[model samples]
Target: MERPFSVFHYGGTTSYDAHGGRRSRDIPAGEAGSGLGGGGLHRLHHHTDHDGRPAPHREAHSESGHGWERLVFSNALQAVSIVSVVQCGVGLSNADVVPKYGFGPIIKFLKVLVVQQILWAVSLSLCKIAILLLYSKIFATRAMVMAARIMAGFTAVWTVITVLIAFFICRPLSDNWLLDLKNRNCGNQPAADGTMGVLNMITDIAVLVMPISYLWKLRLETYKKVALIVTFSLGVL
Candidate 1:
């Protein structure tokens, strides 16, 4: 019988004062807001998987070997969250990201919105790559490994395309935030954004469902299979 595949483990640090207050300190607030705070909750110790694949984030392989991926993603997300909070503090919210005031206010709001979207795209790309790495580490079958690699490649391509589109939607780049343009022409941004949003939702569904076949085909109990499917499906959210 094929053995059960185990998950990867890595070292993570959490800082807190002696009083044990401000749990927010243990998890960076920005990372928490962005759903990347799970890394910080992981224990700061190393444990190898059954397959002997050292935890990529904890292994002494690269310059900043330990928790590098988590750190990079967490920091990026934290910065974005901080800036977003400041933007919201200055009267920008879900109700109205764009203001109906002077040209200066409109441009400022647009700039903040653009920055938020760019950071969100970068965080999403980083998280996708991390997920693919973790999936490959845990799933040993050739098909499973190949599927993860293919997904990672597609994610990288998607990131590049989306970033390029965001930066170049309007010529001169600055035109994206400009309040008025007399002669300069711009493409149909709402249509492009809708296409990207649809593609993103489709890829998310694909990633969430990719392992169902392998999971259900396992020689496990029916209850266990159902439990696994339910657990993995949560990633779709």
Candidate 2:
């Protein structure tokens, strides 16, 4: 962790009846650590699962600790969530800083955003990916996973689309300095665009429908099949 250098500000004595004006005390908005507004809502805290992991949960660990895979996944999810929230808060705080200080401070803040937001977004994506992967635990068969992999592929494609739209697609050139002259003119094509949308619909239907289709192979009641499929689908959505 890096510690920032702090400067001391000394204001003159109080001017108000009760030690007097706004100057009598220091008031900072968005109370962070403790007190009334201390929940630190809309802020990014930490992200341990920077690459890939599932949503957080608590699990019993073996004495060896090496077998604690589930515990690692759950803690990773919590970390990812906190980091994302903190990133959002930091972005919002940039606006407050700009009004109070200037672009000099805000520019430095943007640098932090580059690293933090990337990690936060990755964390959120990893959680979703982890949920999708949880399907493997439900039906750990090669054929089932092949179908599930199709679902995952669509997810990856859609994630890319949303990310592109969120960051680079809007302005194409001016708003984003990262884009180049040749790239700015290269916009999305409708034929290519429809593929992702279709893929998404197909994956959703396939993920749920395939399991039900496979129910004929199992020696279970119609009610049991319906119950199992519906309950599992709930987890997916």
Every model's TM-score: 0.63, 0.38
Candidate RMSDs in Å, in order, are 13.8, 25.5
Global lDDT for candidate 1?
0.59
In model 1, what is the error at residue 111, expressed in angstroms? Answer: 0.9
Tell me the lDDT of model 2 at 18. Answer: 25
Instruction: Write one digit per residue (lDDT tens) for candidate 1, span 1-237.
Output: 433332222211233333322122232222322222333112232344565433436454443544566567568767766764664445454346445433455556566766666666666777776777656654444676898888888878887777778888888777877666675466778998888888777778878887676566544567876787787787645
lDDT of 2 at 79: 62
Give the runs in model 2 whose Cα sits over 4 Å from its true position. Answer: 1-128, 172-198
Q: Please give the lDDT score at residue 57 for candidate 1.
A: 67
Residues 1-237, candidate 2: write the lDDT tens digits: 433221111111112222212223432221221222232112221112343222123232222454244455556655654554454344456667667665554444434433443344344445445555655434444676776676667667665665564455435433333323465543463554476557656655655565554443333456765776686577655
Q: Which pairs of residues collide in candidate 1?
A: none
